[model samples]
Target: MGGAPERADGCGARVRGRSAGSGRLSVTARTRGWRDRAAAELAAAALATREETVGDVLVVGDRTGVLARALGDRGAAVHRWGRRLGEGEVVSAWPPDGTVVLSAVRLPRSRAELAFAVHAAAARTRPGGTIAVYGANDEGIRSADRALAAVAENVTTLRVGGHCRVVAGRRSEAHADGGPDVFAIDFELSADDWGSQRLRGCGGRYRTWPGVFGGAGLDAGTRALVRVMAGFDRSPERVLDFGCGWGPLARAARALWPDARVEALDVDALAVRAVAANAPGVEARLGDRVEGAACYDLIVANPPYHDGKEEDTRVIEALFSDGAGALREGGCMVLVVQRRLPVPRLAAARFRRARPLADEGIYRVWELVGPL
Candidate 1:
């Protein structure tokens, strides 16, 4: 478990990891459940493709292993890029132009995210080169095609299997990116004694691009958590925003305690960029988990619950599991979660002490004290 782990063809082999293009085969986590089904469908569609010549393949999004393998089997050099970057992909500093980009787009995401995919793919594609997006019908693949049409031409259905479909389009010469501004979206948030409301107007003051949790605006639960966090008497010296969305909590912490060293981390690239651009002083990191988050006075979190359509608490559990080791003797981990979530109970199981600081509307803020 060093460098980066890659999921092999099957069998869920994850202990040993291999470098990207060493021609070395790595054991990949077995694709099961919905993921397995989606990959099979997408791979089939990519295989059936003969309408356009594919020289290079660039894949984005989840279910990448099977699809990457399938495209590679078709004799195209495959490069995997997206949120899931480390899983046996020829990682790149930036995507190459004139290449075919395949994306496994999830069904639920902001319009801005879809637009970014369309624009990004087009920017890297040469004229007559194709870009294909695959997802379940529930994921709004057809609607996404409409957005794709904005950046590419000849947009049409490539294939359909089960409840999933693949949409492909060729980037035309007419499309030339003036700038990255076309991907920007406005987030307007209002204050109600809850944090700063994050975004105040549609002037595009916020640095959000796409696909970030709570980047659209402040979540009600997060706002509630912030309100209670502000009421606390002690001023923390060092703060960590675990799963920080747009650096709202981290920014608020910095404003509250100017001397405090606030840091923000997220799994999304857009979020990391947003925080770095919008929140001046905080350290921004793009990563999947908190590994060496040590000796922080306060760790704030509003962890995500779903990976696309699958609902799970694995991430929340990890945050709590790591809390016991990451904090100082008298430090705190403050989590804002929906009323129905079992975060309080989860915290209690890990820390032996969990305090319900505030409960407002559908959100509750829990303060879990770390052990000495």
Candidate 2:
């Protein structure tokens, strides 16, 4: 961590190296503090326990590229899988034969997500190669050994510190068949739930993997939002589905406004791929932020409220602010959320006016007009 600041490492994570001719230090930029704890612990554990040089490595769920940069500095060729495009390669499915010498995973929030990551790592690692998983104890690092045991052997604790733990296991030669595909769950959305006359025959099939919100089916909030869209008097020429999960809003928007150009944006790579598969013809972009001010005619969203297992309002707030900025002068943004959240207040903070559209007891829809 001690060195002059260097240029960004293409993945948006900053890298620090020695000045001029001096040799580089092992520490990379500590941009994400506590969020990088598990990654730091895994890097330390891997570097210490391995008898030989760290060879080809695969890092998963290291959102900030903490482990990837650290391992790369130690002479390991690192490959990273992440949610956003700039973070790493956003692959829907890892190649079956892309085996590596070592793989490090930062445990995800959902158990299904954790299982998918661990199984993928194990399958892609060479027989007897190392698979290391780490996370905070409260975030379910305690179950790392059990999850790895399904696809690996000789599971053991590697390191424990800073309320985080790293567990390692040898990739079992028997599980070379590869892990579950990214599109692991398939479900159909009924036209009746949409409540739109235009969408009566547009019922479509959708595929989703673990971790994406509303993966099981169309959630009640999104359904309510779509219903509200059906009643709009004006047909928007351009539509943006911000935080589009599986592209339900984008699909409905396309069906309702046939001539409108529809776009979908999401941070998750799997979610972006699902949108492409489920809502064909729409532009699905893998990004963490909304681009272009005053570019969209209509924006629809069901912004996420959680940063993991913990409920955080910053996600929704940022979406509101950005969506407002992305709308045209005559455009509006529609949103749905749990009634308990402060949607009206959040909208008022960014838009000139906030109008209530529908309230289904548990979920409420709002229309925000004219960015301030």
Candidate 3:
């Protein structure tokens, strides 16, 4: 659920972690923006008073990437941890003395990760040194504060914008005496699809995993996109469904273009897995990769416009850029998106021409120039 926000710096490139099953998530602007702001605030606070300068710092949680990026920008040594080591790999590979570790998202799903972050912080920071943990109110900031309180009696919370906060505390051996033991919570999920479709969800079958959009069922925008699937030209030989969540578009597109090679690509691994389960014949891939370079005849997508916490058009934009690159000289691309999202402008710039197929205030289908 936690990672970097999209291009506040206009880099256009997005960083993605593993899927929920992997104990990580894609770093979109929604999560990253908050973490970046929080890390900046904490770094400023620590540097504000010259007397508080400790030898090293550590940041724990999913936002470790953001903290690492921010601290590196500020010339501070940084280390990060999460349920999986890859999440912290970028920062961990390059160790810094004034280390900053982020433990903001859910505590590590594994004890090894949790222990690594805690012990690394304690070992790096000198006595009377500062250790800060940041969390969004919705995530687990309150609980993390309680955990930090056990390690550092004087825990102070700094209000960061976007209903997020940065918590600063000092860790010492004494605080470890009565510190809380981290444990995982297990429960069953039961949901009845009260609106529209009736796909009752239970255990692993239900979507609802953290950070997956419309994990419950078809979202309104996605449903709208599905409504227009019947009209798309599916005659191309090699077809790609970008951001193909749960395989609805891929299945329908394949059915319409029976002879076409239909492959679904989604940054969210769960979506890829769902597509595989629901439409076994269709090919599914996790993360953004342009396979068969410049080989696709057509690319279609109902590109995602929102992350869990905010609106990020970057994903959609990147999809178009990558999709266009993969298409043959005369290939075509079709994108369905909300009318207000600025996708049309992006498409116009990237493609030879972008023409509207349908418009319904909230959603519009755009046809871009490709081959035929």
State which candidate has the highest lDDT.
2
lDDT of 3 by residue, 273-368 (tens): 566665557776644534344677777787766643567776666666656767876788877788877755777656778887777567777778
Highest-scoring model, TM-score: 2
Candidate 1: where is the Cα deviation over 4 Å? 1-40, 48-54, 83-108, 186-204
lDDT of each: 0.62, 0.71, 0.52
Tens-place lDDT digits, model 1, residues 1-372: 013344331210112233245552321222224744574466456553653325665665534366766666677666555542333333222233444534333333556677776666666666777767766777676677888788778888867777777777777788775444555555644444344443222123456666667756777887787777677788888888877777778767776777998878675556776787667898876544454445678888888766556666777887787666677768888888877887767776668578788887888788888653
Candidate 3 Cα errors over 4 Å, as ranges: 1-31, 39-133, 136-208, 289-293, 306-311
Ranking by TM-score: 2, 1, 3
| Local accuracy of candidate 2 as per-residue lDDT tens digits, 314-361 | 657766766777788899988898888877787777889987799986
Candidate 1 local distance difference test against the native: 0.62
Please give the TM-score that candidate 3 achieves against the real structure.
0.55
What candidate 2 gets wrong by more than 4 Å, as runs, is: 1-39, 46-49, 85-98, 177-183
> Predictions ranked by lDDT, top down?
2, 1, 3
Better of 2 and 3 by lDDT: 2
